[model samples]
Target: MTSRAAQEEGVQFGLADTGNSIPVGLVTGIAAAALAAGAALVWWMRRRRTTRG
Candidate 1:
């Protein structure tokens, strides 16, 4: 770990544990939406297969 001054001087890169830039709320919403979409697609595929058979 280096001081902020050193980082600013471009002596080190990505060596610090800088906090996440993305908001937790936004991440949670995106994950939830993806899960719901995936579930709906799976359900639709199963229904279509059953009807055709």
Candidate 2:
């Protein structure tokens, strides 16, 4: 009975790990893209303002 319980727990952990990996990867990807875009926008605005002034 203990072995059966251990097997069940292992399966649950494996499933959780598999399910979480993709969304974690996707969130990181989105965050990186957003940061890059924000930096680019700031740089462009600064350049434009400098030229105008």
Candidate 3:
């Protein structure tokens, strides 16, 4: 049963007509790249330390 206020306001709780898929995809891609870069930097630093020691 829907509330009277909801019925009057006509609020839609569903998918957007024009989705924000592109921005979401870009944000996820950038995050993955940042994580990968961080991992690579750590590996490089560890390798350098071992070689120096």
Candidate 4:
């Protein structure tokens, strides 16, 4: 019974790891785009605030 439990646990762990495998390139691209967009938005907001004030 213990052996069967261990086998089931291992299979579940393996699948969990593989199921979450995201490509590094895609992750990096997403991060870069988000950063650029955030920076641009902040810059625009500050510019507008300064102009109005």
Lowest summed lDDT across 10 adjacent residues in model 2 is found at 11-20
Q: Assess every candidate by TM-score.
A: 0.64, 0.57, 0.58, 0.65
Task: Give one digit per residue, the lDDT tens place, for model 4 in 1-34.
Answer: 4767978877443344453578889989999999
Candidate 2's clash total is: 0
Model 3 worst lDDT window (10 residues): 13-22
Clashes of 4: 0
What range of 10 consecutive residues in model 1 has the weakest lDDT sum? 10-19
What TM-score would you give candidate 4 relative to the actual structure?
Answer: 0.65
Residue 5, model 4: Cα distance from true site in angstroms? 6.3
Backbone clash pairs for candidate 2 read none
Ranking by lDDT: 1, 3, 4, 2
lDDT of 2 by residue, 1-53 (tens): 47679788774333434455467878889999999999999999999999999
For model 2, the local distance difference test gives 0.82
Task: Predict model 3's lDDT versus the native.
Answer: 0.87
lDDT of 3 by residue, 1-53 (tens): 47667778997666778865569878889999999999999999999999999
The CA lDDT at 50 in model 2 is 100
User: What TM value does model 2 have?
Assistant: 0.57
